[model samples]
Target: MAQAKKQSSIKVKVQKFGTALSGMIMPNIGAIIAWGLTAAFFMYPHGWFPNKEINNLVNPMLRFLLPLLIGYTGGKMVDDDRGAVAGAIGTLGVIVGTDQPMFLGAMIMGPLSAWLLKKLDQVFQDKIKSGFEMIYNNFSLGILGMIMAIFAYFIIGPVMEVGSQWASAGVNAIIRVHLLPLANIIIEPAKVLFLNNAIGNGILVPLGIQQAAQVGKSVLFLMESNPGPGLGILLAFTLFGKGKSKSSAPGAAIIEFFGGVHEIYFPYVLMKPSLILAAIGGGVTGTFLFTTLGGGLKAAASPGSILAILLVSAKDAYFGNIVGVLGAAVVSFIIAAIILKHDKSTGEDLDAKQKEMQAMKAESKGQAMPEAEDAHESVKSYENVKKVIFACDAGMGSSAMGASLLRDKFKKAGIDVSVTNTAVRNLKDEDGLLVVTQEELADRSLQKTPHAMHVAVGNFLSSPKYDTIVASFKALTQVEDKPKQEKPVKKVGSIDGIDFSKVKEVNFIRHDQHLGTATMATSLFSDAMKKAGKTTPVKAVRINELTDDPSHLVIVTPAANKNLAVRYSDIQTLVVKNLLQDKKLNEAVEKLN
Candidate 1:
C-alpha cells in the first residue's frame, strides 16, 4: 500500500508538471495556427500564393511573438499579470541571442522569473511603509525583471539552443534508423495518461517548428497530432464493444476525428487497458507510413483533427498523410475488433472497469472509496447551486464534453442551473457553486473551491454521478413546484438545552471526512426552511470555526454532538438521527425567532 501510494503520488506530480508545461503552450495554439496558415499561404517560394511582403509575418511570429506569448502565459500561471510582464521580459533576453526560437527557454525562465518575483514581494511588501508603496512595488518588479532577463540572456539562451540541437538530432537519428514508428510504444500510452499536450506542445512543436523553418515541413508535427489511433479505438468500440462503451463511441469518434479533441477517446482506452495495444498499433503504423511515404505537415496541427492536419500539410505530402491516417485506422480497427470478439465478458464488464478506475482515482486523490448507491436516494440536497462547472487539467476537450453532457441533462430535467467548463487552475471559490472534476483532478478542484460542493467522476462522458446529480435536482424541483398543504408553525413552549429566541444562525459541523456531506446537509436544511418561509441563515463550518455564542445553533449527529460538548458550552446544539434528513429540523426551524 505504501509503495502504491508513493507511485501514485509521483505519477500525480509528473502529470501536474506536464499540465503546467502544456498549459503555457495550449493557450498559444491559435497564434501557432495563424503562423502556419500565413506561411502556407504567402511564403515567398513555397507558399501557395508566393507573396514575399505578407510572408514576413511568418518567421517573426514563430521567433518572437509565439515564444513571448508562451512566456507571458507561463508566468501568469505562476503569479498573475505582474508575473506575465516579468516572464515576457525574461523571454526577450533568451530570444535576442539565439537564431533558434526560445520556446524551451520561455518555458523555464517565465515561471522561474515570476516565482522569484512573488517570493521577493512576500518578503519585502510588508516592510514598505506609507505613501512610498507604489515606489517599492514598481522598483522591485523592474529591478527583478531586468536581473532575470540578463540571467536568461547569459545562461538560458545558449543552454536551450544546445538542448534544441540535441533533441532535433535525436529525432533525425531515429528517423534515419527507420525506428521512428516504435516511438508510439511510449507515445500512445502517454496520450492515454493525459500527457498528450505535454508531448505534442512541450516537446514536439518546438522541434517541428525548427525543422519546418529549414525544410518547409516536418513529420514531428504529425507524430502526436494524428487522430488515427484514437479514431481507430473509438471505431472498434462502436462495432464490437458492449454497453455504454459501444453506444457512446460514434459520438466520441466524431469528436476525436473532426473536432480534434483527442481526449474524447481516452476514457474508452482506460475502460479496457489492453485496448492500448490497438492505439500503439495504429500509432506505429501511421508513423511508419508517414516516414516511408514522406508524409509531413508544414506546421503543428493544434487538435490533430483531420481537417486541421490536411490544412497544414506540405503541398506535396498530402498523399502520404492521407494514406498514413487511413492505414492507421484500418490496422487499429482490425486489432481492436479481434480483441473485443475474443473477450467473453458480459455487458457489466464496462461497469466493473469503471468501478476499478474510480477506485484508483479516489485513492490517488486520497478521497474515500466510492460505495455503490442510487443517485436518486443518496444525494441529500439541491439548493443554491446556481451553476455547475466541469474542470480538468487543460480545460479544453474532456471537461467541455462533460459540461455539454450535463447541460443536456439539465435541459431535459428543466433545471435552471448554468453549466460551464474551465481549467482546474482557473477555478475560484464561489457561493452556490458545484464543481465536477475527473477523480484524479478532484483534490485540486476541492482545494480551489473548498466551500463549494464537489463531485469526482471517473469517466467524464458517462459517469453515473451525472445521473445522480440530475435525479437529485429533478426530485427537488418537483418537490418545490408541487402543491403542498400549508402546516401551522408549531409553537414550542420549551425544549431541553435550547433557547429558541437566541437562535440567529444554524450550522452543520464539517470535519475533514464529512465536509461534502455536511455541505449538502446545510443546503438541504436551508432549502427546507426556505420552503417553510423562514429566513434564518444556515452554514456549513468546521467545529473550530464555530463561535461559542448562544445565538448560533449547531446541528450534529449523536457522535458529533458528543464531540461538540467537549469543546463548547455557550452554543445551543441539536442531536439528530440523520444530519441531512432529520424530522426534528423542521421543528427547530419553526421555533426559531
Candidate 2:
C-alpha cells in the first residue's frame, strides 16, 4: 500500500508538470494551425501553390509570433497580465540569436520571468509610496523585462538550441533502429491517464514543429494525437462489450473519430483496463504504417479528429495518413475483440466503473472524490451565474465540443447566459461564473476558480448534468423576467379560520407512494418555522400514526383531508394545494405556537 501511494504521488507530480507544459502550447493551437496551413499551401516548391507573399507568414509565425504567444500565455498562467508582458519580453531574447523556433525556451522563460517579477513585487510592492505606484510599476516591469531578455538571449537561446538538437537526434536514432513505433508503449498509457496534453502538445508538438521546419512535414505531430487507437477500442466495445459500455460505445466512437473529443472514449478503457493493450497494439501499428508509408502532418491536430488530421496532412501524404489511421483501427479492434470475447465476468457495471474512474482521476488531481450529495446543496450559487465555461485538460478538444452542446441547449431553452470553453489552467475566479469540467479535471478547475460554482461530468457528450444546468438557469431567467405586483396580497381568511395557538406539533401524513415527498415537505416546513423563530415541532407520519388531538396540526391535500376527517373528529386539519410550497401553509407556519 505504501509503495502504491508512493508511485501514485510520483504520477501526480509528473501529471502536474505535464499539465503546466501543455497549458502554454494548447491555448496557442490556432496560431499553430495558421502557420501549418500557410506552410502546407504556400511554401516554395513543397506547398501545393507556392506564393512568396503568403509564404512570408510561415517563418515569422514559427519563429517570433508562435514562441512569443506561448511565452506570454505561459507567463499569464504563472502571474496574470504583468507576467504575460514580462514572459513575452524574455521570450524575444531567445528568438534573437536562433534560426530555430524556441518553443522550449519560451516555455521556460515565460513562467520563470513572470514568477521572478511576481516574487520581486511581493517584497517591494507594499513599500512603494501611494502616489508613485504607477511609475514604479512601469519602470520595474521595463527594467526586469530588459534584464530577462538579455539573459535569455545570451544564456537560454543557445542552450535550448543544443537541447532541441539532441532531442531531434534521439528521435532519429529510434527511427534508425526501427523502434519508433515502440513509443506507443508509453504514449498510449499516458493518454488514458489524462496526460494526453502533456505528451502531445507539450512534447510532441514542439518536436514536430522543429521537424516540419526542416522537411515540411513530421510524423511526430501524429504520434500522440492519433485517434485511431481510441476509435478501435470504442468500435470493439460497440460490438463485444456488455451493458452500458456496449450501448454507449457507438456515440462515443463518433465523438472519438469524427468529433475529435477523444476523452469521450476514455471511460470505456478505464472500465476494462485490459483494453489498453489494444490501444498499444493499435498505436504501434499506426506509427509503423505512418513511418513505413512516409506519412506526415504539417502541424499538430488539436483534437486528433480524422477531419483535422486530413486537413493538416502534407499535400503528398494523404494516402499514407489515411492508411495509417485505418490500419491502427483495424489492429486495435481485433485485439480488443479477442479480449472482450474471452472475458468471464458476468456483466460489467459501467456506471460503477465510471464512478471509480472519476474517483481515481480526482485522487490523481489531488482532491477527494466529488459527492453528488451536495450537487444541489448550493443551488443559490447558480442564481447570479452570468456565464458557463466547459473546461478540460486541453481546452480545444473535449471542452470545445461540450461547450458547443451546452450553448445550443442554452439557446433552445431561451437561457441568455454566455457559454464558452477553455483549458482548466485558464479558468479565473470571478463573480457570476459557473464552470463545468470532466470529473477528472474538477479539482484543478476548483483550484483555479474557487469563487465559481463547478459541475463535474463523467461524459461530456451526454451527461445529465448539462440538463440540470439548463433547467436551473431556465428557472432563473423566468424568475428574473417576471414582473412584480404593485401591492402584495396577503393570505388572510385562508389560515385565519384555523386556531394555530392550540397547535404544538405539525404533521405531514405519509402514504406508501408519497413517503419521500411527505418527509421532504415536513423537513422544509420545519426549517421555515424555525427560521421564523417558532418553537413548534414538525413530523411526517403514517395516517394511522396521527393522534386524535387539537395540539397536532395536520397539513394535508384535499383528498387526504377528507380521509383524515373520517379517521378522527378531534384532529384539526388545513387543506393545502401543495405539501411544501403553498402560501397558506407558509402563513400558518408563522402563526404556529
Candidate 3:
C-alpha cells in the first residue's frame, strides 16, 4: 500500500511538472504564427507579398504584447505572480536571443524562462523559503525581475541583432546566387505551408490599408494582382470534390479565396492530410505561375485568397492574376483528384469512425445530463450565498492582478463581492468560486468543482475582458464586504551552518547540479543569496561541500537531499514539510506563523 501510494504521488508530481512545462511552451503558438506573418508581409508587397507598413504596425504590438500575454497565461497556470513576472522577463531574453522580431524570440523565451524559474523554485524552495516570501511580498521580486529585463536588453539584445543581420544576409545571398528559381518554387509551397501567415498579415494588410485610401481602385486592383492559395484550394475542390462535398466546395472556395478567410479550407484538408501535399504542389506551381506572369500588388495580402488578391492588386495585373488563379486551380484539382481517388476507402472509414465517436460522446453526455445539471445548480447557489473566490494556477501574479481588477470593477458597480486569489485546488464550497483562467486550465478546476461556472477568459486578467465580467457581476449584485486581512508574513528557520541571526531573508539559486549547468546555477544561487536582506553579509557554499556543522543547512536537489535536512528535529518541522513540495511554498510560509 505504501509503495503504491509513493508511486502514485510521484506520478502526480511528474504529471504536474510536465503540465507546467507544456503550459510554458504552448501559449507561444499564436505569437510565432503572428511573427511569421509579420516577417513575410514586411519582405513581400505584391498581392501575394508583404510590405514595410505591415512591419511597422505589427512589430511593436507583437514585441510587447505577445510576451506579456504568454507570461500572463504562464503565470496564471502556476498561480504565481512572481513566476508570471519571471516569464515576462525571460520572454524579453528570448526576443533578444532571436534574429527574428522580439515577438518571435519572446514566444520561444517566455516559456523557457517560466520553466527555468519554476525548476529553480522547486530545487531551492526549502532552502530559501523565507527569502522567496520576503522578496515577493516586499516588491523585491519586481527589482530582481528588472535585473532580468536589463540582462535581456544589453546581453541578449546585441547577440540577436548581430546574428539576425548575418542570417538575413546569408539567406538573401543563397536565394540570389544558388536558388533563384528554387526560391520561387519554394515560395508557393512555403507560402501555403509556412508563408501563408506572412501573406495574410504582411502582404495583404498593408495593401488593403493602402487600397483603403482609394477604395474602389485598390479593391479592383487587388482582385487581379494576387490570387493566393485559396484560389488553388478552390480549384482543387471544384475539380475533385464529390457528391455533397462538391456542392460545399464552391462556398468554401469563395470564403477562402475572395472572402479572405483561409481557415475555410482547413477542414477539407484536415479530412485528408494528403491533400496538404497536393496543396503544397499546387501552391508551388501557382507561385511560379504568378511570378512568371508578373502578377503583383502594391500591398500585403490579407487572406491570400483569390478574391482578396484580385481586390488588392493593380488594374494592369488583373489579367495575370486571373491566369495565375486559374493555373493554380487547375494544378491543385488534378493533384487532389489523383491522390484522393486512390484513398476513397480510407476517407469513408474516417468519416464513419468520426460519426461513431460523435454518437458515443452524445450517448455518454446524455447519461450524465442530470449530474451535470445538479453540479451547475449547486455552484450557482453557492455563488449566490458564499464568498466569491477567484483562482488561477499561481495565486499571485495574474490572478492577484486579475482579482484586484475585478474587485475594483465590482466596487465601482456597487456589487457586494469578496475576491481573493488562490490556487485552483484550494477552492472550497464555502468560498463560492468562479475561476477566471486561460482556456487550457478550465479542466483542472472544473473537475473539482463540476458546477462552477468557468469563464474561459483567455488571458482575461491582462485585457479589459476581466473588467467586462466584473461589470456584469456588479450589475447583478448590490452587497459588498469589508476587505479581507492581509496575508501574514512567514518567519525564517535557524539552520546551523546558515546564520539567520544576522540574516533577515534567504535567497535560492536553482540549477541542475548533476548536469553541466552547475556553474550557471552556482552563479544564480550566489547572486540571489547575496541579495537577501541581512545586517551582515554571508557567503554561500554548495550543499555537497558543506561541513557537518550543527548550524549549517545543506541545499541540494530534492531527489538526493530529501533525507538530509529532514533528519534535523530543531529545523522548524512545519517549514521542512512546506519546502518538500514546490507548489506548497506560499502555504509553507503561511504555516510559519
lDDT of 2 by residue, 171-211 (tens): 87887677999999999988887889899999999889988
Query: For model 1, how big is the CA root-mean-square deviation?
Result: 12.5
Best by lDDT: 2
Candidate 2 C-alpha RMSD relative to the actual structure: 17.4
Candidate 2: worst 10 consecutive residues by lDDT? 369-378
Model 3 CA lDDT for position 162: 67
Rate residue 356 of model 3 by lDDT.
Answer: 39
In angstroms, the error of model 1 at 192 is: 1.0
In TM-score terms, candidate 1 sits at 0.78
- Candidate 2: which stretches are off by over 4 Å? 1-9, 345-348, 357-370, 373-389, 403-421, 428-435, 449-455, 464-593
For all the candidates, what are their Cα RMSDs to the real structure? 12.5, 17.4, 16.2
Candidate 3 global CA lDDT score: 0.46
Off by over 4 Å in 1: 363-366, 369-378, 429-431, 443-451, 478-593
